[model samples]
Structure formats: C-alpha cells, structure tokens
Target: MLLDEASIRRESEHVEDHIKRWMTVEGHFRILTALSTQMTQDAISVAKTSPLVSELYGRLLTGSALLQLAQSPIDRVQCSLDHSGTAGTLLADVWPGPCVRGRVEHAQSTQAPLYGGDGNIHVSRQPARGGELYQSVSPMHASSVAGALQHFTMESEQVITFISLATVVDDDGQVTMSGGLFVQALPGMTDEDLSKIKGCLAQAEFEDLVVAGDHPFDASAAIFNDVDWIETGTDPILYRCRCSKQAAVGAVRTLSSDELAAVRAGATETVTCEFCGTDYIVSAVDLDAS
Candidate 1:
C-alpha cells in the first residue's frame, strides 16, 4: 500500500509537539513515542495472512514514533510490531543510544517454566540466539500488550518509563488499528523528579483519548498540562522490509555443493523472508554458476 506522505508528516509533527510539551515540565532528556491505527492494522494483517509468517496469532499491530530531546534538535526513532498469542517471539535491531533492533517471543504454553500468569517473553538481541526470558506478573491472570511492553522496558533497563497502549479489533477478529504512548526519563534524573513525572502520567486520560481517536500530542498535553513547549521537527514512520533477492541468493550459496545441487534439482526452489513474508525464487542456472 502506498503511504500518504503528507498525512504521515502531519501525524509525526503532532507527536513531536506532544514530546516537546512534556519536556517543558520535566526539563531533562526524554523519549516519547506513538503509533497510528492504520499502520498497526496493516502490520497485523501481513503477519496473519502471509504464507511465510506464522509466529504471531490473535495479534495486534503496534507502531511507535520516538522523539528524544537532545542538543541536536530531536532524535527520531520508529518501531513497529505485529504480535499475538499467549507466547510469541520477536527479532530486533539495535542502534546507537536507546534505539534497539531485536525480536520478542512470547512462550505459547501456559505450562512453560518461564510462563508468568500472562506469558513468557523472550527478547533476542541476536536473531540466531534465543534471548533473555522475562515472565509476566499480571494480577488478573491474563496477557496484556501494555504488560508485555512494560516488561520490555524494565528488562532493557530504561529507568522511569511510562507506557499507555490500546488496540481495537472488529468482531470478525481483524485488528482495525492500534496506538500507544511512551515516556522515558533519561539517566541522572532524580527520584523526586521521576515521581512527579509519574504523577502526571497517572492522571493523564490516556485510554479515553486513545478510544476517542485523539492525536497522540493531545495525550501528551494532558500529561504535561499548561507547560510551554517548542516545536522541533517531525519524522515519518513506515513499515518496510530490508530483504532483497540478492541477499536470498547469497544465503543459498552458503550451503554445501551437495545441498545446492539438491535444491537445483527440484522443480522450483524458493526462499521466503520470515520478517516481511517476501518470497525469492532460486534459479538452477544461478546455482550452477555459483
């Protein structure tokens, strides 16, 4: 699907404005993130219908646009995910600073050792290696997106982070859309300051705003109330895959000669990317040349 760049830009600006407002009250480094419903639904649909993807079920799509206050204007970070079921897994990539790239997997079986009443979440920094395990501690004996994300924040060692997430699914079990709000206090923040920030977050009517389809900035404003904020800049968030045909072929070439020959002998050889559900067909001629 084609993205309306103008619309995305407007939404991004709205989120950034909220972050700036929050920063005025806290007066320190912070990261604020939000996602649109359309972006979330599209991701969930891909995960549910893609022939090559199967890790998530009964899932929701979540998107995030991160705005960090710094000396160099605003540092933007984007995150998107399609996850579901009692237990699931995720792969992510990490960049410099607080931006992380990796996967999160929730254990499917309630009987699993690591299963907390909710689910067992496995976060892998390396896609090849499994990941560190985090068990949920939901008092109500149910799994929740917000709960899972809170676990992630603690495990990742982000001090003083507040997250508000909500999802809407149609009766037919299709996700209509999803969105969230995230705020994090940077290091060196005093406990007193953190407590005040948390107080503001606690009083914010996040669920109501989200349900009403309010802009993310509005939610931030509710949390910061009357604080004067500056407008930095905006950035777009998109769901895209980095897979390429050449990358697929390169992977096939890594196999032993015998394995390569076996693949070439088949009527059709194909490789599918688990991340984006993209298929790449392998050619016998290409295999022979390698």
Candidate 2:
C-alpha cells in the first residue's frame, strides 16, 4: 500500500494583492510545498523495517518533488543522487502533475551513516512520451540533500535555485515528516523581479519555514502584481511503491530452476523491494514447484 498522491494549487487573490502592494512586478510564478503523508508512510516503513537504507533515499524523493515543482515551466524532470561513499544510489522520477516515485538501491535494516564528499547528482528533463530528454550532472555538496540540489542548479542550469528540506525521525529513528520547498528564478524574468523574489525568499528564511513544524507553512509567491487573478492548481504529493507480488513473480519466472534452488539454499529466501523495503518470501518448496 504505497501512496502516490500529487496536487497543484495557485493563489490568485493573494498574488493580486501582492501585486498591488509591490510597485515592481513581473509575470506570474509559482511557489510550491510538497508535504506528503504517503512519503512519510513509505519512508517510515522503509526506515523502521530497514533503518540503514531508507533515510537518504526518502529525503531524495521528497526533495525531488520540490525540484519538479520549481520547474513549473518545464514539463518533467528526473533527479538521481549517486553517493559512492556510504549511502547507495537514490532515484526520483517527477512529472507535471508534480507526481513522484522513487527508490533506494542496496537497502538494509540497520542505520548506517553516509558521507557525500565526492558523489554525482544528476537532473534531467524529459517531456511526456515525445520530447527529447535533457540532463545535467553536478557534484554533491557537504553530503546534504538540499545543498547538493543548490549546487546542481547553480552550476548546471545557471538558474538560481533555492531549496530547504527537513525530515523528522521518530523515537525509533524512522521518518515522520518529509517535506521541503524550492524557489527558482524563471527564465525571461527581469533582474528586478528576480531580486525581489530572492529578497522575499531570504526574508521568509527557507530553513525556518521548513523546520518550524508547528507554524502553518505558506507558499505565498508574490511575483506578478500587475496581472489579474487567473486560476489555481494543486499537487498533493505522496509516497508510492511500484512493487507488486505479480512483478516479483514475473521476475522469479526468469530464473532457471537451478538458480532458484541456489537462491533458496541461501538462508532467508526473501526478495526485498529496493524501492520501499517491503520483503517477499519465497519458500524453497514453492520455488521447487514453480
């Protein structure tokens, strides 16, 4: 039961009001916060069941949603983090609906620390079923998820992208709250407009906004002051695992009987879903019959 929910909403009246307040204005731009209960559920399940592997991947997934949202002008983006030091690879696929699905490779049940000194972070854009796919590669920074993304945007895209992420770990060291925000300077946007947006974001203080769980989070983007209130969209992001018993069965079907026997002979005949840390047991007898 993985959750994959996404929504998109806008603030027309708010934007209008802001436009009236600020003399300097530009075209409409969006501000988005993707706080996903499904993400929390999935992360917690993976962390609790497999502490060592789920934490980093969970944050990467949550952060990917924010990155996708930042690219409102772009249709789709794929973010992948490869940490060669300690933590494994993390992949996130994001689309216009701001919908996201992600997974961690080589997960385990114990908590292990990861260092991100010399790893690679990749961001790419691949539109619906037709358009060409474009990608950029950047190096990870200080081993922080948000920091890595900041580097990617600043270095690769030449766009000033600001981001902040926070994930609450319960007493058992499992993820409870996984959410973040991403703000970027839109293309063709005037320097004045960009400066104003940057000033406002600095005033809001991304870390404070994200870490302050008690306060009501606000995505009030005050950019276009001259335009009328047009419309609003919602993108309620969620956690969803693309793993299924049938898929597992299909995968198993590919293995020869001897290979199956070899796998069964190895203790713990379990097939762990790398995406969500859900394990499927395949008894030796079952494998023999199949």
Candidate that would win on TM-score: 2
Per-residue C-alpha lDDT of model 2 across residues 1-290, encoded as one tens digit per residue: 64433212222221111111111224334445455545655555654435434545656776777676655335567788887645567678766555566655555534345636678888888775658888888778746777888778778768776666666555575554455666555557677666666767656555455445421144333222332332344455655555776666557756787776676786335677865667787655555554
Which parts of model 1 have CA positions greater than 4 angstroms off?
1-22, 29-31, 49-118, 126-143, 172-177, 231-233, 262-267, 288-290
How large is the C-alpha RMSD of every model relative to the true structure? 8.0, 8.5
Candidate 2: where are CA atoms >4 Å away? Answer: 1-25, 49-58, 69-78, 84-88, 93-113, 124-136, 174-176, 214-216, 219-231, 253-272, 279-290
Q: Each candidate: what lDDT?
A: 0.46, 0.58
Q: Tens digit of lDDT per residue, candidate 1, span 1-290? A: 87897678765553332222234334553535454444444444554432112112222223123322221122223222333433344333322232322233542234232222433443323212243432222222224445555555555564556656655555554544345566666656787766766677768656457557665555666766644444444433434455787788888888788878887787445888766568998777766654
How much lDDT does candidate 1 score? Answer: 0.46
- lDDT score at residue 136, model 2, on the 0-100 scale: 83
Model 1's TM-score against the true structure: 0.62
